[model samples]
Every structure is written in C-alpha cells, then in structure tokens.
Target: MSIAGQAVGLFAVTNVDDLLVLALFFGRGSDRRATWAVVAGQYLGFALILAAAVAAAFGASFLPSGVLPYLGLLPLALGVRAAVQAWRHPVDDEQPAERGGPRVLEVAAVTFANGGDNIGVYVPVFATAGPAGTTGYVAVFLVLVAVWLAAGRHLATRPAIARTLSRWGHVLLPLVLLGLGLAILLEGGAFGW
Candidate 1:
C-alpha cells in the first residue's frame, strides 16, 4: 500500500473503538483544561507508540526474516492481559470516577495500553517503508488523531450514543484487541511457531 493508504488503513483499524473511549471521556463533562490534557496525553502516548514501531521496524532489518513475525507476540500478550483484566473486573466493578476521570498520566497510560495492536500493525508496515514513507505515515497519523478527537467530542454530547458506548465499550475493547493481535500474527505468518 502507499504510505497514505497505510496510514489511513492503520488509523481506521486501530482507532475505530477508540472513539467510544474518547467519547466516554468527553461525556464526563470535565473542564476544558482536563479535556485538553487528555488530548495532549493521547498525542504523547501515540507518538511514543509510533516511535516504538518505527524503531522496531528499522531494527528488524538486522534480524532474520522469520524472527520479524514473532514480534506479533507482543500484541497477543497484551490482548490476553487486557482480556484477563476485563474478566476479573466485570462491568459492575467499574466506577464512574474511574471511568471518566482524566489525569494526563491516566489518559496516557490507557492510550499506551490500548495501543498494542497499533504497534503490531505498524511494525510490519514501517519495516517495508523507507524513511520518506515513514515520514508520510507519521504526518497522516498525527493529523488524523486530531480529527478523531474532534469526532469523539462531538459524539459525546449525544446522550443515546454516549450511554450505549459507556455501557459496552470496555467489554468490546479487549475482544477487539484480541482479534487485532490474531490478525497481526496471521498476516505476519507468525503462527509458524
């Protein structure tokens, strides 16, 4: 795929569910400052994710081709961890304060935690992309992140949408991660292990 295509594809796949999480955050009716902090934290966290992917992709050039696919295990492990957490906690245990509160670090932590699939998908894409392609992908991703935040904030005001997302979002996220991880492994031919 072209760099633009890759960026858009990656962003759409990795962030389709994030809109729900972002909407949940905005629905909290936190002060503007807190909302912006969450945005900043999200950007910071995503930057870190992209940086890691780029680094890994660059480094993978030195590793055997067969070994590169094993990198998918990182996301697989993360998905399992998230699934276990969701299973242990269940729906009722989630408090409103825990769900809606937006400390910068908390937002960053969640962004990073939820980004396992991003790393998995990005690493392979970046591995094939030259520096110019990587740059283009980064630019597109960064721009789309702002667009995503805006869309989430807009969605937050819709009571029906926000309520529905709040109710089921957490339950769905782990499953999405699991699917993404499996897809990554399959796409990378990591299952040969």
Candidate 2:
C-alpha cells in the first residue's frame, strides 16, 4: 500500500482510543491546542516505541514471525470488548470534565496511556519497513494523527455528540478494536507474516 493508504488504515484503527480519551478528557480549553498536544504526544510516543523496537530487533527479535497479525488483532479485540461493555452497561447522561491542562507532560501521559497497542503494532512495522519505506510510513502516520486531532477537536466542541458518544462509547470500543485487530492480522499475513 502507498503511504497515504497505510496511514489512513493505521489512523482509522487507532483513532477510536484517542477519541475515547479525548471525550473522557473534554475540558474547558482551546480544543485546537489540546488536540495538537494530545495527538502529537501520541505520535511521538509511538515513534519512540518504534525506535526502542528497532534497537531491540538489532539485539534479539522480540516479535515472532506470526506476531504482527496478532498485534493487529489487538484493536479488534479491544473494540469487541468495548462494545460488550457498552451493551452491558450504558453510559450515563452526566459527563465529567477533563482534569488537566494541555501541558506537554500531561499530553504525553495520556498518549502513553492510550498507546499500548499502537506501540505493539509499531514494533513489527518498524522491524519490517526498510529504509525505503520509512519516510512514507512516517508521513502516513503523521497525517493520520493530524486528521485524528482535527476530528477530536470537533467532537470535543459538540456537547450533544460528546454525550451520545459517552453513552455508547464503551460498546463502541470493543467493536472497533476487534475490527482493527482483525484487519491488522489479515494485512500482516497478506504482506508477509
């Protein structure tokens, strides 16, 4: 796939968690700044994790041959889990305000908290994508992050949307996670798992 396509796919898979976090963290502030801070922190955290994976690969391969697909499956599983949760326990009308400022540190913490699966998947992608593919890969990832931030900002501003999302957010998570995980698993296998 082209860089654009890859980024879109990755972003779509990863955006759910970011969206959820943003909803959870919705507070009175500049949505634009908060979005950038959160999204940038996430992408930066992902990049760092990829770097660490590269370093580890140089010494001992942490991911097995079949690991990439499994990593991809994470999102699918998470999505399903969220959906189930939502079905079982619906969201309440009252939504809590976000607790922190757009401090770089806070953003980084939120990013890290939400980036576990992203980092896991990145390990394989970084290990596999050679020098020729790195630029495109990075580009795609960044664009996706930017797009996600934009969407998140919009969502943050819309109280009705936020309320609705919160009411069904738990349910949505599981389905989205499951789909993303399955897509990654399949894509990895098709490409060369």
Candidate 3:
C-alpha cells in the first residue's frame, strides 16, 4: 500500500476506540466551547503520542536495522494484553465519571491513556520508514485526527450507532492489533518466519 494509505490504516485501526470516546465527549458537551476543548485535548494527546513514537523510533535506530522487526513484539504483546483484558472485562468502554467535562486536560489524559498501543505500533513502523515516509505518515495521521473528530461528533448525534461501536470495538480491536502485529513481523521477516 502507499504510505498515505498505510498511515490511514494505522491510524484508523489504532484509534477506533478513541472515536467512540470522542463521541461520548461530544455527546456530553452542551456548549460550543466544550466541543473545542475536546478537539484541543485530542490534538494534545495525539501530539504527545506521536512525539513518544518518534523518540522511540530514533532510539531504535541505534539497534541494528535487522533487529527492528523484533520490536514488532511490542504490538503483538499488547494485542494479547488487550485481548485478555477484553475477555476479562467484556465491556471496557465505561463512560468516564467526568463525562467529558470541559477540562481539556481530562480529554487529553484519556487520549493519552488509550494510546499506549499506538506508541508501541508506531515506534518500529516509524523506525523502518525513511524520513520522508515518516513525515508523510505523520501528516496523514494528523489530518485524520480531524476526520475522526468529525466522525465522532456525528456518532454523538446517533446514540444507537455509538453504543453499537462501543460494544463491538473492544472485540474487534484485539483482532486488528493481532493482524497488524503479525503483518509487521512477517514484513520484516522476523524470526525467519
């Protein structure tokens, strides 16, 4: 796939749950300012996630390039972890007590909390890409953040759709993460598989 396509897929797969959360946030927001707070918070959280991923990627460069594929284990392990959590918790997307309160920091905190897997998946991918490719992915991902917000707000207006996604996302995310992990490992010829 093209770099932009890859970025979009990565963002969508990783952030699917976030979209639901964003919907909830918007759903709670009765004021225009509250809506903007959620948007700002999402951006702040996403920026930090990207920063951590980039930093990790830079650190990874010191390792032999051949070893990069081993880093795919990060996501593989996380996928297993998420699957276990989903199995145990079932409905993990509980509405936060704060209910997307107007605190920008609150939304950012939730965004960051949800992004642990994103950083894990992004690190090796970014490390593998050339500078131009990484930049392209980042650009694409940033743009998608807006798209996600708009989509989330739309979901907010439709409670039934939001609930369905909330119910199914936990089940699907694990599968997607597992697939992404295996694909990464295979692409890198990890363990000669």
Candidate 4:
C-alpha cells in the first residue's frame, strides 16, 4: 500500500474503539478544559505508542525476532488489568465534577492500554517506510486524530447514540481490549503456550 493508504488504514482500524471511549468521556458533560485534556492525553498516548513502534522497527536489527513477539504480553496484561478494574467497578457513577470527567492520566492510560493494534500495525508500516514515507504517515495519523475527536464529540451530543454508548460501552470496552490483546498475541505468534 502507498504510505498514505497505510496511514489511513492504520488510523481507521486502530481507532474504532477510541471513538466510543471518547464519546463516553464527552457524554459525561465534561467541562471544555477536561474535554481538551482527554484530547491532549490521547495525543500523548498515541505519540508514545508510535515512538515505540518506530523504535522497534529501527531496532529490529539488534533484537532477535522471537523476542519481539513476546512484546505482545504488554497489551495482554493491560487488558487483564482493565477487565479486572471493570469487574470491580461495574458502575460508572462518579459525577463529572468529582472525578473531573476523564482526567488526563485516565484517558492516557486507557489510550495506551487499548493501543495493542496501533503498535502492531505501526511497526510494519514504519519498517517499510523510508524517512519521507514515515513522515507522511505520521502527519496523516496526527490529522486523523483530530478528525476522530471531533466525530466522537459530535456523536456524544446525539441523545440516542450517547445513551446507547453509556449503557453498554463499559461492558464492551473490556471485551474489546481483551480481544485486541489476544489478536496481537495470536497474530504475532506469541501464543506458544
């Protein structure tokens, strides 16, 4: 695929769940500052994820290929943590003011936790891309992140959609994270056990 195509594809595929998470955050009626915090947090988290992918791509020469597959454990562990947290706190009843409507760290943590696919997809693209292509992919991804946030924010204002997401989003989120982690393990051939 062309660099642009690859970037778009990766952004679309990796961010499907983020849209829901963002909507859930926004549905809580967070103040503008808090909402922007979520955006900033997501950017920070995504930057970290991309940096790791780029590092892995560049450092592939130094590491044994088998060791790279084991990196899948990171997301698997994150998924398990999220699932446990959800199980313990089944209801999200905290007021927006009380918890500040998705703190930056919370959003960042969730973004990173749910980023197994982002890393998996980005590493291969970064590996194939020349410097110019890598730059193009990064640019595309950054722009799309803004587009995604806007879409999620807009979705949050829709009554039916927001209600549906608020109702079932938490339940689905853990499952999605678990699935993403399992997929990474299986796809990377890290499931030798």
Top-scoring candidate (lDDT): 3
Worst 10 residues of 3 by lDDT: 92-101
Q: Which residue pairs come into collision in candidate 1?
A: none
Residue 171 in candidate 1 has what lDDT? Answer: 56
Q: Each candidate: how many clashes?
A: 0, 18, 0, 0
Over 4 Å off, model 3 = 60-100, 159-193
lDDT of 4 at 130: 64
lDDT at position 171, candidate 2: 44
Model 2 worst lDDT window (10 residues): 96-105
Candidates in order, TM-scores: namely 0.64, 0.54, 0.62, 0.69
- When summed lDDT is taken over every stretch of 10 residues in candidate 1, the lowest stretch is 93-102
| Full ranking by lDDT | 3, 4, 1, 2
Residue 62 CA displacement from its true place in model 2, Å: 11
Model 4's number of clashes is: 0
Q: How far off is model 4, as Cα RMSD?
A: 4.4
Model 2 CA deviation exceeding 4 Å by range: 26-28, 31-40, 53-100, 161-193
What would the per-residue lDDT of candidate 4 be over residues 117-182, giving only the tens digit for each residue? 677677777888866788898899989989988998889778787665566555554565567566
Better of 2 and 3 by lDDT: 3
Report the backbone clash tally of model 2. 18
RMSD of 1: 5.7
lDDT of 1 by residue, 1-193 (tens): 6778868888999888678667755654457876887698779878877887888888843434465455555545655865686577677645532243455664565565567567777888888887888899999999999999899888876778666555665555556556655665676677663
Could you give candidate 3's per-residue lDDT for residues 29-120 as a string of tens digits? 54788788989989998997788788778784343446655655655665586579667765545652222234587567556645766787
